[model samples]
Each structure stands twice: as structure tokens, then as C-alpha cells.
Target: MKNEVKHVLGLSGGKDSSALALYMSQEHPDLDIEYFFTDTGEELEEVYEYLSMLEGFLGKPIRNLDPDRDFRFWLTQYNNFLPSAQTRWCTKNLKLKPFEKWIKDEYTSQGYTVYSYVAIRSDEDFREGLSSKNKSLVTKLPFKEVGVDRQGVFEILENSGLGLPKYYDWRSRSGCTFCFFQRKIEWVGLMERHPDAFEKAKSLEKSALEHGSPFSWSEGETLDELSRPERVEQIKRDHEKRLAAVARKRVVNPLRPDEGMVDLDEIYGQQKICLACHK
Candidate 1:
């Protein structure tokens, strides 16, 4: 084993990871940190566009770690089962596998102690399953170490002029356009903003159901049922009602005035996100 270390970071095209890229570049300029994005090929166009803008700011092309097999291939391998919170074959194959392969082939075999910088904010708990079992692969949380919370994440992006991804205007979490982790409201946002992607998801869900897969992209109802005019209106009304309730209960934090802003995660509650794909 060589007495050396490699520093690397992954960008999820979300605010937190993007901000971490900017933060590291500014705070630790001397470290030659390699940045990469694991593309699932099913992501939003806005994700790609935002990453392009990020490249101009970083002055280094973020490497794309494309999986060897596409999503369709994996779907077939899983007998047309759509990945869900209970059965997340999508993240396993499309996100984590590629990164694990790259590190094992390029860095670990080359005898480098690889430090992976993850964007787990200080305010968030150290979620289960984030730790690496491989002795050579070390996971580091700079945000947690430095006490950079959700507020700090925004400040970093705003100061860097990267603001947030365009999808933030409608959708909240970052990952595949049809990520099952999405809330019902986010699915509606997808249907309105990117109908093509929404249709693709609907088609995929239909196929999955026909093949006896128990999971739908959205909980309880299939996309076909969810996309109906009546159901869409019902979802909208429920969303608005929740929003009003949250507004009424919100206590203004003087130190963090922006806390009053409605967070999508707050409305639906934070789901168990894919660490690799989201951050």
C-alpha cells in the first residue's frame, strides 16, 4: 500500500452537495479534490443544466460516473419491479454500485486511503447506513465537523452565485425524476413541469404493476390513478391545507428569519432519502 490519500466528493445537483463543492474549493484550495456525479440517466434536464453552470464556477468538469447497465436493464433484472423504499434496487445499481466500482478499481487497488466527502449537514443527524465498512474507504463529514447547518448550506450557495437548481422552484429533493422517495405533491409538480418525464414514470409504473410488482412510484395509488383530474385537485387541496397548517404553527426564529419559508420536506415530512443519490 502506498503512503498516500485521495480526496473525492460527489455532487447530487442539490443545494447541499453543490454548496459543499463550493465550500471545499474556497476553504481548502490546496486540496486537489476530485468531484463526480453518478448519472442515473433518468434525472431531470434541470439537473444537467445546473451541473453545467456549477462546472463554470468550479473551473473543473465534474466527472460523470455512468452505470454499466441502464435503469431498464435493472428493472428487467428485478423482474420489472419498480424500486421502492422497501426494495431500492435502483439506488443499489444506479448510484452506489458505480461509485464503489470506481473506488475499488482506481483508488483502493492503487493502495490509496480514499476519503469520501459527504454533504451531511450539521443540523441533520448522522443517518444510519452512511458508514463504510471498508477499511481503506473513509467517510468524512466536513459540514458536520464545521457546524454548517441547513442555513449555512444556503448561505454558501447564495454567496457562490449558484443559488439553487431550477427544480427547486417546484420540486424539492434531487435525484431521478421519478424517484419513489418523492412526495405526492412533487409528483404533481413533475406532471405539470415535465409531462414527458411524468408520462415515462407512469408507463414504467404500469409495466411494473402488470408484472405483479407490488410497488407503485407513489404510495397507495398508481400514477394512472394519481394523475386523474379529480385526484390531482384533491392532492392540491390537501397540500394547501397542510401548508396553511404549517404556516399557522411556524414560530419565527429571529436568528434564522428564513425559517418561515415553506420547506417541502416539512410539509410531507422528511423521508428516508438515498444518501448516494440525494447528497
Candidate 2:
């Protein structure tokens, strides 16, 4: 018997994914895509707000896929070692597992084919995570298929009046509020903007250290050490130098230089960021 097929898109509450969602809604209005967000329980407040704005634009509720267990539970399961880029149990347990569980039960169990839309930009190399183990679940990249780069993403957001997320001014990428992938300067921004969240991250790192974990939230130093006045100043100074270098490289395109400007990845070297979390 032939099975029904479902089109779905997962929004990461980051600019690229949000832009992709808006792009899909406008370009493929005929396709009834079910948009979803895999919540980590430790996401930034701005992420929730932006999700709401996206919901309004889509005229549909973004289904939230929450793990059966939260971060603290998973932390304990990993012997109190905080999840780092090396061992990202947080993404597996919190983000990807919940999503896989939902889709496996809903679509695979019912013998339905699932088309999952991902936002891997044309400028970026396609990584390995988006692949689905279930043969019934197919992954799609509309942005890459249409050759939409970072600038095209920005234009899509601006044209839709959704602009970038408010945290873009400070944080370069979106994921957990205490995402270990954050650079030293972003840690300072966290200390300044969300002191409570910063403190929570510090306490978690302290616990991990006490448990003899090899990693801190950031490498080389503890959050307590990083938050010191002198260290903070140093990080800020280094970041300013990087920004100045980026500014110098910016060529004035008379047509849309002001509008296009620069993006975070340009100023800060693009790390091996998770597409599910940062896209």
C-alpha cells in the first residue's frame, strides 16, 4: 500500500533557520510543511520570543519537541561532566533524540514518508548530521537547492520584517544560553547581559571541575576566572581588534553595502557549529 508523505521543517530559533522558514512559507506555500522546534530547556529568552514572532508569520504553531529528561538529568547521566564540543551529549539527548523519537513514532510507525527540511546555506559545506537513519525519513535542503547564501538569508528576513534576533548584537550564534561553543568575548557578553544565566553556567562548570571533568564551559579557564575584571577587559579588547579588522576588509559596494554590512561569522571564524542548534 502507498503511504502518505509529510513535509516538515525544524526551526532552531537562529537567523538562518528562521530565514529558511520564512523562505519556505513564501516560496512553497502550496506545500503544507509542519514547522517544529526542539527545545533544550536552557535556551535564551530571546529564542522563545523570536519563535513567537515566527509563529505569527507562519500562521501556524511551531511544535515544541522537548526531551523526556532535561539538561540536569542528562548531566547526571554523564557523571556530572558538562557537555562540551567534544562530547555533545546535550545535543543528542536534548535536541536530536527528542526530534528522532517524535518523528519515528509519528511517521515511521505509521508507514509514512517524512521530508525534513534543513537550512544549510549555499556558501557553507554540507556536514553529516542532517542524515536520517530511518529510510522513510528523507532530508531536504531548500536553501542550498536554491543557492541562497548568507546575504540572501538576510534579505529574506529584512523583506519579511522579521530582522535578526535581538541577541545577535551580542551573541554570534544561538543554542543553549551556556553553549560551550561560545568564544571568550561571548562569555563576557553573557556576564554583562544575563548575569543570572552566567552565574548558573559558572556553577555548572564548578561542579564539572569538582567531578574531575576535562572540559570547562570554555577552554583553558573557568567562567569564574574568565569573568574577572582584567580578563573581561582583555577579551573585549581582543574582540574589538577583530571587529576593526573586519571593518577594514569591508568594501563599500555602492549599491547595498550599508544594508548587507557584515555578519558574525565573518568577524569571528566559523567554528564547527551544530546545524540543528546554530542554523
lDDT by residue for model 2 (1-279), tens: 349999989998999999999999999999999999999889899999999999999899999998889999999999999898889999989888888899888887788899999999998886768777888999988888999988888899999999999899988888999999998888998899999999999999999999999999998999999999999999889888889899888787787665546666888877889978998
RMSD of each: 1.2, 1.2
CA-lDDT, candidates in order: 0.90, 0.89
lDDT for model 2, on a 0 to 1 scale?
Answer: 0.89
lDDT of 1 by residue, 1-279 (tens): 786899999998898899999999999999999999999999999999999999999989999999999999999999999999888899889988899889989998889999999999998885754766568999889999999988798889888998989999678878999999888988999999999999999999999999999999998999889999999999999999999999998989898887556778778887667778887
- Which parts of model 1 are misplaced by more than 4 Å? none
TM-score of 2: 0.97
Inter-residue clash pairs, candidate 1 = none
C-alpha lDDT (0 to 100) for residue 132 of candidate 2: 70
Q: Please provide TM-scores, in order, for all candidate models, with all chains considered together.
A: 0.97, 0.97
By summed lDDT, the worst window of 10 consecutive residues in model 1 runs over: 126-135
